[model samples]
Structure formats: C-alpha cells, structure tokens
Target: MNDLGFTDEEIERYARHITLPQVGGIGQRKLINSKVLVIGAGGLGSPLLLYLAAAGVGTIGIIDDDKVELSNLQRQIIHTNDNIKIHKTDSAKKAILDINPNVNVITYKERFSFKNAEDIVSKFDIVADGSDNFGTRFLANDVCYLKNKTLVSAAILRFEGQISSYSAHKGSNCCYRCLWPEPPPKGLIASCGEAGVFGALAGSIGSIQAIEVLKEILGIGHSLNNYLVIFDTLSSEMRKVKINKDNNCKLCGSKPTITSITNHKDYR
Candidate 1:
C-alpha cells in the first residue's frame, strides 16, 4: 500500500509514478490526496481524465452534460461505441474506475455556467478546462481566479493546440482573459466537428494538460506559467510565447474591475 492508503493493486498499478525521483512516495501521497476537477468529458477531457485517474488522483470530478455519441469515439478515446447515448460523465466514470477503483469520481451531469461554476470549482483543488465552448472556458477561468485555484486550460483545433496555466500563486501570471480579452466573433470559431482536428492532436495537447495538473498538484517541474505553449502537429513543432498579465485585464488586473461572474453576452 502507498502512503496515502493505496492498496497493493494500486501500488503495482502506479509503480511507474512512484518510481520517478520527482514523484516518489511523497508525490504519490500528494496525488492520492489531491482533488482535480475536469470541465468536460469530450476530446481533450478524454485523455486528461484517464491519465489523472490512472495516476491516482484521490478525487476526480467530471463536469459535463454531454452524452457519448458514435462520432465522438473518433477522438474521444475514453468512451466506446457501446456507450453511445450514455452520459459522458457516466462513461468517463466507468472507464476511470475500471482502470483504478481507488479513484473517487464525482459527476456533474449539467453544463458548467456562471451560476454553478463557483460552487463546482470550489470543491476541487485544481481545475482543468476541456470544454469546447468559449462561454464555459471563460466561466471556468473566472471561477478559478475567484477561488484562487490553479487552472490548467487547453484548446485543440484542426492541427494546432495550446495549453497554459493561470494562478495567483505563480506571481502575476495571466489568466485566460489576459490572452483573449473576448471570445472570437461567432462563425470565426468552428468546433472540431466542423473544422476537423487530427485525432492525435487532441491527445497530444490533452496529455500535456494532464501533466501540467500533476505537476501543479505535486508542486514539481516547470509549468507553462505566464506563457502559452503552442503545438503544431502537422509540422511536429512546438513554440512557447511569453504572455503578460494585462494591466487592464478584467479578471487579474492591477485596477481590478470584474467583481462578479456575469455571463458575457457575446458568448451566446
């Protein structure tokens, strides 16, 4: 058994994790006591959820109102054809528990919005945004800033993807709003369903997102703090660009303005 009450099976299963110098017995315990909330159960969420659970994150909360569809299986590796029509959260929970029953899976079968975002996010230590829409992404960022929680955000489209982390603890780092003060005009953005993302693109970015979360929880390694890491799957190239916290950022600005989590009308 591990330091955090992991069973013999868990020890064997997570042996790879425990053996790492950066993540030894102490890190394993941290993971066992850590609580991470994932904001979606689709594409990006699939790999993030599976790896986090398999790594033995003590408590995992999945917030998604979507159901598994046959088409989703093409990129969403967690769900299966047999799970079509099943709630995405339910399907993810089953898959995670099947891999490691030690994990505690919490499901929010409703969409995350300004109304419930605070409450849902407050219950976990770290928040990972795998939601596809801008509204939910902004809501998650605002809630994370308000709760002073570490937020690991990632987005995948076509052959490109980006990942970053925002936290007050990281010393004046930028939040999602700092990068995109406003969502792209509607029709300017297209979902994977329409634009078509390479299957491995989401996997690559999502897995990096999971690593960011693990590093945050274990308090180890350099994270994508105050910078955005962009991956181009087609060219097999990656770039990191520095990002500064806007002095007038709505969320984390010096003059600080946005006091409430109000829905941005433009998102609709």
Candidate 2:
C-alpha cells in the first residue's frame, strides 16, 4: 500500500523513465508492483541492488549468507567500511532502503540451495543470478525453469562478463545448463578471490543484469531471450552471440530430461 502511487512525487522521481516511450505511466506502475529476487549480494549484486532500488522495483529479495569482510570492500560497493562484519543481506537491505523507501526489502541471510531455491524464487516475478559459482547458477536455473520464473543471469571473471535471460514462459531459449552442459571439474575454475576481478567490471555487468530484469518486468525492449552478451572491458569488446536452444538441452530443450536439481559430483 503505497500512498504515493503515481503521484507527482513518483512521477518526478521517475521522470526519466516515464518520459521514455517504452515505459510510460503504465509501465512505471508495473515496475512499482513488480517483485525481483536477487541471489548473492557480493560484487555483481552491488550495482544490481542499487539500480533496481533506485528504479523503484516494488519488492526486492536479497539472498546472501556471507558477512562483509574488508577484502570484499574493493568490489562489493553495497557494504560500507562501517558495515564490515555485517551480513551482506542486512547491508544490502539498508542500502536499498536508503535508495528508495518505496521498495520493500526481504533479506535472506542464508545460502540459496535446492531446498530453499524453489520457495524463494517462486515468490518473485524474476530472479537475478549474481552468484560466483557454477553450482548455484545451475541450481537457480533449474529452480527458475520449474517455477516458470524469468531468470536474468550474469557472471563476471577477471575483466570479462556475460549476461542473458531464460524462461520457458518466453519459449525455447538456452538456459544455464545449455551453455555449460556440466560444471567444470573441481579446481578447474578460479574465483575472483584467486583470479582477481576488476571492481568496475563487475559493476558494468551487474548493471546490465538489472536492466534485463527491468525490461522483462516492464515487458519492454527485446529481451535477451536467445542471446548472450559478452563484454571484455580490457579490450573494449562487446559481442552478442545468438544461443540456439539445444534439442537435447537437459534443462530447456524440447525433450527436456532434467526434472530436478541433482547434486552433481563435479560441482562439489
């Protein structure tokens, strides 16, 4: 129950968005009533939370089990120096509330797993995957497919990033599993902690993820349905490769076989 629903204050607050042909008063109202769930409140989650809150997404759920450490400050912009040691979900809730009191923040200070993924993701109109690991990504994708929820996903490593959207509701499109049929062997991939990622690089990709979520919610723009946009900040290269839905894709293919989230041995 928002008192300022479409008021001059709201119009002024989102004047830029309202002016756009794609998003008028109706679309602004849609945004005010939309619910988005964001997984992980770390580097990629930083900008996604900020921009989505500032854009007036009605309800935003943030899930993260980790606490803010001094090491995370270099990239996790949502947590302040004074907020160190606090749970990331708590820190993100405060930041979102500060950006726009109109947004309702739900904080889950726990990791997203197969057990809780469906329940949490089912509550939102869309889910943004900012997770740093492949296990969580696969889990989120499968859960979203089951729940028929739009999944706006992004991943960043070093100076490169990739963003895409997946939903059976939108019809045939490759899902996370379609891209990587199986998780890389253990120790095959290095995390930002080990490989190190540019702080701004995560921001760039996370912001794009937020935009994709907004577009899906507002039903505006050509959603990234079957394409993956890859960005290389160092070389200043941006590429959008069309992704064909795999006929044998275990997740979203025509004769799909993956019906549940199974703990893959390699993911461990």
Candidate 3:
C-alpha cells in the first residue's frame, strides 16, 4: 500500500493526483473514502460519471430509469451503440468499472423520486445533478438541502449551460431552490429534446460538475456554492454570478417550508 493506505495499483493509477500539493495522498484518500451519487446517466451525467470514475472515487451510485437510445449517443458518451437497449444505470456502471476497476458502482434502474431520494441521497457524501428535467433537478436539490449533502448541479440546452453547487446547510451558501424558488412554467422552458442541445456543450457543463464534486470531496479551493456559472458556447462567454439565498426559500431558508419529502408542506 502507499503511504496513505492506497494499494500499489491505486497509487500508480492515481499517480498524478497523489503528487499534487492540493490533492496529495491525503486528498486521494478522501476521494477513495467518498461515496458520491450521480442523478441521470445521459447528457451531463455521461462525462461527469466517466471523469469521476477515472479519478478513482471509490464508491459511486448512479440512478437512471431510462434506457439508452440512439439519439443519446450524440452526447451520452459513457455508452456506446452496443448499449442502446440497456438501462442507463447498467450502461454507466459498466463504463465506470471499465475505466476504474477499483470503483464500486451501485446501479439503480429507477428514477429519482421522493420515495427513494432520501434513502439514496443520505448514503452518499456528495450528490451530482445531471438530470434534464426541472422536476428531477428540483427534487434532488430539495433532498440534498434537507439531507445536508453537498450538491453539484448543472444543466445544458442548445449552446448554453449553467452550473452551481449548493450547501445551504453550510449557511450563506444557497440551495437550488434558494435561487429558483419554483420551477418555471412548463411551456416556458424547452428541454434538450424540444429545443435541441449541442452535444459538446453538455460535456462542458458535465465536466464542470465533476470538477466541483471532486473539489467538494477534497475540500480544496473556493467552491461554487452561492455562485452560478453560466456558459454560452455560441458566444464563447462565461460568467460567474453570485446567487443570494432567499430568506423565504421553501427548502433552505430562515424558515423552511419543506422539511419532509412526502406531503411537501408549503408553509408559504
């Protein structure tokens, strides 16, 4: 084993990470000890999962109810044409294992629902949201906020994408709901399916999400908490804007109206 209890194989696999001053043997150990959950196995989830696995994150939990589709190959690089009919969770688990045998992957072939969110989110040290829908995204944020887990959230559409980390439990840091009190009107927003997204754009945002997850695990550098990163690949513009927590935020605020997953008591 290496000085940090890493096996000789692990040390060799993560040689670069172990040599970095910010993420030396100590940080590498933290990563191995970390259990991270990734929501969705398409688009943003693809690159994030691959990178996390390659980074040697020991335990990874992936939840995805859908099956891979021919269209998904455009951006979901974790899966190949052979996995078109397979469940996303299964496809992702296979890819992750192929990249890093040391990683223990847990595959859940189901969507993230209130019934399962708590049990799943509670087990992981950190959560990453790569889901495409507002419902799933909001659910993840609320659950993470309530469970006091750090959340790395991101979304992509057309040539633009946004990313942010939330840990309202840390105080001053904003939860996803803190910035978006509620989901936008259904018709007002167009999903990747409806509006179409640039495949590589998803990679950009998902990579950022993966970087944030690693930072949270290593506790290095300034986090994305309370900062919203917006990227417009079309214009090649990137902006980092501050997000202030809403005092009346239903989930993470001075007085939270969302305490339980079920029955969602809206005190507002």
Residue-level lDDT of model 3, residues 1-268, one tens digit each, is 3556877788889999988999989898999999999999999999999999999899999999999999999999999999999999988999998889899999899878888999999999999999888888888888887898999999999899999999988968788887888888777889789999999998889999999999999999999999999999989999999989888887777788788887342211
Model 2 misplacement above 4 A: 1-5, 262-268
Better of 2 and 3 by lDDT: 3
Give RMSD (Å) of candidate 3 vs. truth: 2.0
> Candidates' lDDT values, in order?
0.88, 0.87, 0.90
Q: List the residue pairs that clash in candidate 1.
A: none
RMSD of each: 1.5, 2.1, 2.0
Please provide, for model 1 over 18-111, each residue's C-alpha lDDT reduced to its tens digit, 9 standing for 90 to 100: 8898998789989989999999999899999999998999999999998999889889999999899999999999999998888999999998
TM-score per model over all chains: 0.95, 0.95, 0.97
Clashing pairs in 2: none
Residue 6 lDDT in candidate 1: 67
Candidate 1 Cα errors over 4 Å, as ranges: 1-6
lDDT tens digits, residue span 56-146, model 2: 9999999999999999999899999999999999999999889898899999988988768878888898999999998888888888888
Worst 10 residues of 2 by lDDT: 259-268
Q: 186, model 1: CA deviation in Å?
A: 1.4
